[model samples]
Target chain A: GAGVSQSPSNKVTEKGKDVELRCDPISGHTALYWYRQRLGQGLEFLIYFQGNSAPDKSGLPSDRFSAERTGESVSTLTIQRTQQEDSAVYLCASSFSVFSTYEQYFGPGTRLTVT
Target chain B: AQTVTQSQPEMSVQEAETVTLSCTYDTSENNYYLFWYKQPPSRQMILVIRQEAYKQQNATENRFSVNFQKAAKSFSLKISDSQLGDTAMYFCASTLQGAQKLVFGQGTRLTINP
Candidate 1:
């Protein structure tokens, strides 16, 4: 329970359906990140949230992909009209707010399977 | 853009022995961080070790240590006295200054044989 927690350990969804993955980062961690790991591929950056700083949206793959965080706690990645190729393990990580370190604590990612 | 590469796709080591996993990266910045993460069957991504690019001394944590070659841009992880519990997927990652994006390698599948 102390580590970052993700909901729906596994999700099977129909193509063109909407799917929302929830991530509950460790308490007091100001920086939260979203990453996607496709089968046989490395993790790809998605979105980031820092306390009060504008969320970095550069890593977002497309306009259809969006995320939001409520007061630096629970964050959700919403995939609208999910496609089959969108299947992957979505990972969420959080780190203490430090200017010089990038050591992030990760969660057991949610495995999404779009059929 | 920075990228991490793990050349060894799969590695095997005898129980109680030592093995090293190789990782390389391409970066222009002088200051950054390199990390090795382990994902076991439980699927929890655990930080094995971390190294700051500017530090010359190697970072060590119990049985895990890292060999960092700054000029060569290589960061390798060495696991000593490997146990069955050490079998897992190991990922090498890098991140830059003033950013939260972590670039990761494809990961190496490690197995410890008894």
Candidate 2:
């Protein structure tokens, strides 16, 4: 079975530039999530989508960060005006459902560097 | 606000040995779930094991098991018969009912020596 997949395993861009990271969740998955992991740090929640509805966006660091998922399948996270502080690994995950018992399968992640 | 804590920054274990990783979390919600995830060099977050707060018995999966203590808000992962492939960054996460928002710990870097 195909697992959750993310594109552009690594990316380097200048400061103030905008970047888009793509994710392809497993088929039949109705829940997608985005998270950030900075160097030597833990994973920070970014946003979550459940069946086209994102119930939680509070974890997004700033307005420059946004994400969208179409038809509970593909998802993209956009970071506008990237800053040096934004250098980190952007992780994408999807689950069978948003229920308590469901397990999340993570993608390889996109390592974004704002140089 | 809920927060997960992993006090151990790094740990090491010889092959065939056993090791334990400590984790503690704070949440006001009565019902929630705790998870131990492994991230190897590949950087994919894999679920090693999970435990529901409502269940008293610990959860075990092959070589990976967790000691879940609801009252203490502690969930520790114990790896038995450690193998070289077990080396990675282990993160502890918690999510409360309906929130689905995961709070992750700082993570513990575990090294398995051959």
lDDT of 1 by residue, B33-85 (tens): 99899989777889899888879999999999999999999999999999999
After superposing candidate 1 on the true structure, give the runs of residues whose Cα lies further than 4 Å from its correct spot: A98-102
Could you give candidate 2's per-residue lDDT for residues B1-114 as a string of tens digits?
A: 899999999999899999999999999889899999999999999999999888889999999999888889899999999999999999999988766667899999999999
lDDT per residue (tens digit) for residues A1-115 in model 1: 5989999899999999999999999998999999999887778989889987789889888888999998878999999999989999999999887343856888899999999
TM-score of chain B of 1: 0.98
TM-score of chain B of 2: 0.98
DockQ of each: 0.68, 0.79
Whole-model lDDT, model 2: 0.92
Best by DockQ: 2
If scored against the real structure, what TM-score would every candidate get? 0.97, 0.98
- Lowest summed lDDT over 10 consecutive residues: which window, candidate 1 chain A? A96-105
What does TM-score give for chain A of every model? 0.95, 0.97
